[model samples]
Target chain A: MSGRHSKHDLETTPDDKLLRKLEAKWEDSPTRVLRWHKGLDVRGLDCNSAPGWDGDKDDGGALVAAHAEELSELQERLFADGRSGGSRSVLLVLQGLDTSGKGGIVRHVVGLVDPQGVQHRAFGVPTAEEASHGYLWRIRNALPRPGYIGVFDRSHYEQVLVVRVEGLEPEETWRAHYDEINAFEAEVAAAGTTIVKVALIVSKDEQKARLTERLERPDKYWKYNPGDLTTRARFGDYLDAYQELFEKTSTDVAPWHVVPADKKWYSRLAVTELLLGALRSLDLGWPPADFDVEEQQRLLAET
Target chain B: MSGRHSKHDLETTPDDKLLRKLEAKWEDSPTRVLRWHKGLDVRGLDCNSAPGWDGDKDDGGALVAAHAEELSELQERLFADGRSGGSRSVLLVLQGLDTSGKGGIVRHVVGLVDPQGVQHRAFGVPTAEEASHGYLWRIRNALPRPGYIGVFDRSHYEQVLVVRVEGLEPEETWRAHYDEINAFEAEVAAAGTTIVKVALIVSKDEQKARLTERLERPDKYWKYNPGDLTTRARFGDYLDAYQELFEKTSTDVAPWHVVPADKKWYSRLAVTELLLGALRSLDLGWPPADFDVEEQQRLLAET
Candidate 1:
């Protein structure tokens, strides 16, 4: 309430001021509270709800736009920190069913920052080379280097979710992956990479609507997959698989955040807010110059 | 003058309409005319000049902004094309001396598009692993996959430019890189990748001023390098090296655009325009649906 302002006001405010104002308004971090915990029922969650947001699509869009500058600036500082000997980075893991807005988050939210500072990888069905290695091998190779915001469109959890539900691996094989993933994530987290695991949950009804819309538009056909329909047939199994995976893999080092993603705008806003919170938690300062500034200035003047 | 309009008009027009209007205005492609030639003298090029643009900073900035949506859309179409069985991609190779605005172009120009579709790699000094391989090995590995725009901050040209000037490699070794690079680029271009090579040319005076500015700002300190002063001392040598480079390697397949980059805004705008022209030349259209749309739609509706 303290930082309440019209969209126009938010647009015109200077970056630091707007960032501070938005921070004041979002001090409680509603999106952060969405972190997955034991006993949380995935089946009971609302698909279309916007959690702490009460605005329409336009207002939600405006809020995301307002956060753009702050997010961009924070990402730059993070990059600068890494360039100046800081090894800290953030990894955002996106897992969702078909048409659950994983690509949308990448376009609308992760797209807000400098591309130089982001490492985005979309993992589809593993290739021959990838399948030859451990499941985490490709994920390990895709981890963001120091100073980057690494995005995994579909990530390691596919091992537990799809691999489990589809019986691509034996139950014993897939079940052990939960602990292996947790251990891997804990190691990454300890080595200065903050992991943000997000599951974008859309209802079966919403998924039908989305897939129908994709089929209705010629421009969207490339995004459609017949395999998605095959996967959709076992929707209940996927939910159960995700529920068990969340319970086993959401750890002290890196917990999961389940976002209701029927509304594309809200999912984007929520992800952006979650990313903002992760970055702000770094509490970075501009890396100081190791060289003598005045000496460099004098040397340059002579040149 | 076909589509010349005020900045306000550009900001308000719809995306497709604006794209058409701007395409008409840029029909002659001024930035493309800046492409390096066999006899062109790199030393004689005016670093402060804006080439075809006569506007001041505000207009230049507006022009770049106007191009943003169209560029973003074209990039998306490029991505879509690649996603739906197209192999074509764009590689914007940015080679410049210290303080020449390579990073700025990546941030302001290529940054206009989706990060999901961008593969950005900044090649610094070769690591032991990189050094152990053939010079082009890392370059090959970093090439953009289908559906991506790859920006190399400094590219293989460093072998010819810095390696030659700094005596890092013997003259015969560095000299042979020209044909190797040309052959390498030809193969890439033949494989459906359009390579846009850019050399951001900044004068010695401008470099001094920019370095001094970096030294003056605490926030920019990390960007400054003491070694840059050492490089500045060899400015003329670099120009000579670049001149010879253009003569030897400016192929029909991957011609270099030597941009005068003293003004940051002009360089950013020019690079944006050059990239715009490259994407436009692709003559891309949205990929059509691969599946039976009506059948898919019916199935989704039943779901």
Candidate 2:
């Protein structure tokens, strides 16, 4: 308990074997794991860290594959248990650099459940309408309803990360987002949502390779936007911003996990494990039969 | 073409065969189908009419089952086509008496697609925050993003139907919703979303029988609310309200379809076909590949 499920990781326990294997296999958090530039030194910490897989992509893939069925079942129970009322839900807040496989996480990882159970959104630039309100306005509206799995591919954290890095707000305004985000997450969690935040830690080299692929591949061209390069040029600034983000935002109630995402398979598996862990921690079970099953079965047969 | 695709039908051609069978088999609009008490006559139509299937539930079931795979594929194409920045989405607005099977449509019909493609919401009573804004404020936010299918279980129509019947607002205010709704639908349609509204026509007798079943069956108790009987008492008034609704709100761009929903299978097939038609009308295809596929394929192989 002291070394592993320490107070920093909060009190989450993996929901199933697959999630357990994943947690055991990875560097728990990037905060301690590669030494993220303690105050502008900008040294140590390899972006390509895939801590638990022994540098073996196949092993990670197989592990995730093994857990797929159970993960899906757990998700179903999580959704069903939420229906009786209360905000019993899970909101997986995914934040990553561009081309960091957010879409893939949505499709391959979360896509395993019934569509009726999800309310997924990918937050991009705020529309003029959305921008009129506080940054958290549209986000509050998108919070998952009771008995749902609300996936935010990118979320309110942007107010601090991207907004802070790009000077979208004055320095004072951007600096205020840390407490704002924490307050927002705490409110959502108090409302019966288990908030699991994951940052896909991809290397700059990997992002460059991905951008090159988009240029080189016709099918991927639609996904390419010129704006990505502007963000890429300011990578160092963003990295510093993220480091500051971890320092200010990681909380006891909603801890942030920076999963090494250079390996798409490894990152996806780790994220899945984290989500399953949150769900399992809830001890979700099917809502009790609303009526007498035996009598209903007899009546159904009569019908 | 004149009789087969009458102007009254509002000019829709199904996107594929299942949809064709569905539309060809049912009365195009329930407004005309139900003998809506047109000022004391009360003898123009019956509440239970399935014009196309010889009133056989099995035929409808077989038809829907036949088109299941194709419908799923078409939905995927519809979703994939919308990923590029445009309003190419479908909003299926369902209005019906309770237990007319809105949840069923979402589960059995819409459930076939990858959940990533859907943004399904069931609108109940507006929360305190929602009531603070104009009714449409939250609605506009809930509209499906491009490349998604948005299914509103109960929609803005409730503003006119339930709110009007119960006098939640003054006569002057509820009366104003007609043009307000028409303007809203027109705006949404003009922006690229094809709106297909369906009113599930269930006879009072059928509703009683269904409600009775809910009481008799244990599994369905969760679905029952005593308040449904109060609404049922106002059935005649509600019918008049709906008649007025159809007259003022149905427009060429976004018309209403009334399907005989006494038979669950028939209504489900009818709706599936309607959605398939809307998707088909978009002529959605994989967003034209933006990069050189051959080169990417070659590079992909090298990697």
Write down the lDDT of every candidate, Cα atoms only. Answer: 0.85, 0.72
TM-score of each: 0.92, 0.66
Candidate 2 lDDT over B103-208, as tens digits, reads 7788678765656778888899999999999999888988987888899989898988899889899989988999998998899998889898887777777887
Show the lowest summed lDDT stretch of 10 residues, model 1 chain B. B1-10
Clashing pairs in 2: A25-A52, A218-B291, B15-B277, B25-B52, B30-B258, B35-B45, B82-B147
Would candidate 1 be rated incorrect, acceptable, medium or high by CAPRI criteria?
Answer: medium
Q: What local lDDT does model 2 show for residue A83? A: 60
Which regions of candidate 1 deviate over 4 angstroms? A1-27, B1-27
Error of 1 at B19 (Å): 6.7
lDDT of 2 by residue, A1-303 (tens): 011232225555554444566546654532344222334232234557665445377767776776655566666666656665545889998888898888778866776555677888889899999989988999999998887889998998888888888888899989888988888888888888988887777788788888777666444566666667778877888877777787787777787777777778877777767776777788765556555655544443443
lDDT of 1 by residue, B206-267 (tens): 88888887887777888999999889999999999999999998989999899899989888
Residue A223 in model 1: lDDT: 79
